[model samples]
Target: MRILISLCLALGGLLSLPAFALSDSGQQALGQLQTRWAEIRYELPEKQREAAFAGLAKEADQALASEPKAAELLIWRGIILSTWAGAKGGLGALDLVKQARASLEQALAMDPKALDGSAYTSLGSLYYQVPGWPIGFGDDEKAEAMLKQALALNPKGIDPNYFYGDYLLRQKRYAEARAALETALQAPDRPGRELADKGRREEARALLAEVRKKLE
Candidate 1:
């Protein structure tokens, strides 16, 4: 009788070990995914970005399934889909964009303040990148508002700073763009910061050179 009892307890413990290991592994995987996502954000080429995003999407889906209530996984999934849309182009892009939007919405609903306002930053970029008007998608005003909110949440976050600078540059507000870009370039360990800094400085110099030409 005692032998049987011992055997049952061992079996139960063995079964429980897998569950505990899986839970810990899932958390670790999620952390690695976030770090990889950040590192790849600026390194990926336009063509390669789609493939990378697809991989990220797959990993995120697996993580979400394993931990259904993980809001961070949802946010990562949304970011991957959104980036994929940008890479793919055409009507298919629109579909991915919609998916991305929904995923981010789900993330926000799960946790309004997940990952330092990352969801808001994603939405802001979506609005800024998509076309405006009858074609549907894109809203510069909305983009500005969302990005501002993200900044409010994470005043020194790299993404909001870089994107906001790009927005200003598009408006040809040279001085403002320069200021914002400078701040973005200075942001700690921001992916592609050095490259972006070089690009922005070159742009500023060229713009100033043009002004000089005109004055001359």
Candidate 2:
């Protein structure tokens, strides 16, 4: 959990705008995953998150098995796995992150712009959050590049901006972080995602408060 403070604190929502290519079955499966994921992520107790996310990750895996070609499902799977790893924590979490990275990369290869470039958002978060060198493939440069690409694709997206701002805050670029986070706060509400939007705004506000303190 501590390993992903930057991301968890910054995560708006991994479930992105609909992908037109998704089959009816895949869309249904993704909807179920989306609703459950949000509930577990925002409403579940901290102690229960590891189990909840772990179970959901497996469900995501199952969903992908039925629609191996759906980039949206794969992206969500990556997000679920990444958050699962965060909730699990410790040496055991390494394998989950690796799997998450693989899923995101596959989604990017399948469709770089799928889900409003959500694969980029998840991948960027993982790159910076995971360890580097012998431990994992975490790279600051790669993270920044991927994040910037996400921003280019969806400048008004809450997740990309929040994650980028979080990354900037981590890099000690407080002023830029504040600007990015403020942009996140200004993102328009996403219809049918009021809960997620509320949660994301709360996160952005919390992080913005931190950024403001740094500015002072």
Candidate 3:
């Protein structure tokens, strides 16, 4: 269950950059992707969400095509593809996860600090969420390294804190996980992300409650 939750990290709204600062087309692309992300995470039924995310993946591809070297665009595209892979599920989604990883790697190469280090967050989540053997390329060590870098880059961002907390929880580092989640709960809200912020805060609260119980 926790793995499933972690796979849907896109719902946490990792893109912390203000939309107003983006180019008009970039803003529009992000807006569209976020809307589809919300629909996949909240509104759509489990069976239908995969198709919804597939459509969003196409949109993300178009955005990346227009701004091939834009780190911001690459980050968003990675987010979309990651969410799409989560929705698709099973071994069939392996390719999508790989694509997401590649997109994030490109974004990192172009600008590791773009969108508040969101590419690292997303890539780290993918590394931990996918299978580790013949099935996929997951690596807990790599995930931890990447997530720590993300947190270092964006210590106060809700997404990084929550993700690191989730990673710690999965590793049974309950005390550290609880602390990270608590920090995530205290993160300030972004101007245009009220819905995403509210949703993520609720998730953090719930996870923190679970960690508290475990610590007890």
Candidate 4:
């Protein structure tokens, strides 16, 4: 009787568990997006990149549709749209950038700590990289604040450090930029992210060279 009672108690506990966390299918979708994004960002030729990003955007859209409030899905969608804008530059790209900004904003609202604070890093990059008044909503102060928040959340993360470094370089804070870039270069590799790690490290090295020139 005691054994049977314990079994029922365990079953009751299992049944009471919350379902707010990501489903297995949602996790799988996020992994697929990461893999495909890395391939598009690192392996695809420049002429083919925009088309690839369009496909990624579609995949992200589907993933979000399946799990509308999934913070990770929203973050990936934002990233896909942002990269698509960069690949499809011109007046047309402005709309894509706006959409990307909105997606990231929503993700931030949902879960600011999701994906190691990736939403903050990407949004910060957009703020500094885009145009200012009359064209876009770029603002150095906003960018600085977002990037600093991202760094605070993920002090040792590669993307946050690299982006912060790039922003510093653009602001002509060469010394600080170089320091951040160096830290990015030393970041640990993530599983299933070999291509991304290689590409980002190369970018950091290239930018570090430019920073060195400015210092000299």
Better of 1 and 4 by TM-score: 4
Which lDDT tens digits does candidate 2 get at residues 80-157? 888888888877888889998899999998888887788888999988899887777899999999999999988988
Q: Pick the candidate with the highest TM-score.
A: 2
Expressed as tens digits, the lDDT of each residue in 54-106 for candidate 1 is 78778888888888776666767777777666666666677777787788788
lDDT of 2 at 187: 91
Estimate every model's Cα lDDT from 0 to 1: 0.60, 0.82, 0.80, 0.78
Which residue pairs overlap in candidate 3's backbone? Answer: none
Ranked by TM-score from best down, the candidates are: 2, 4, 3, 1
TM-scores, all models, native as reference: 0.71, 0.91, 0.90, 0.90
Candidate 3: tens digits of C-alpha lDDT, residues 90-198? 6677888888899899889887887788888898888888888677899999999999998888898898899889989989999999999999999988766676777
Clashes of each: 0, 0, 0, 0
Best model number under lDDT: 2
Positional deviation of 20 in candidate 4, in angstroms? 4.7
User: Worst ten-residue run, lDDT, model 1?
Assistant: 4-13
- Stretches of candidate 4 off by over 4 Å are 1-20
Candidate 1 residue runs with Cα over 4 Å from true position:
1-26, 38-46, 190-216
For 1-216, candidate 4 gives per-residue lDDT tens digits of 111000000000011112235688987888888888878887888799889989989999998898998877887887888888888877677787789889989988987878777788888888888777787788999999998988887887788889889999989999999999999998877777777788888888999999999999
In candidate 1, position 203 carries an lDDT of 46
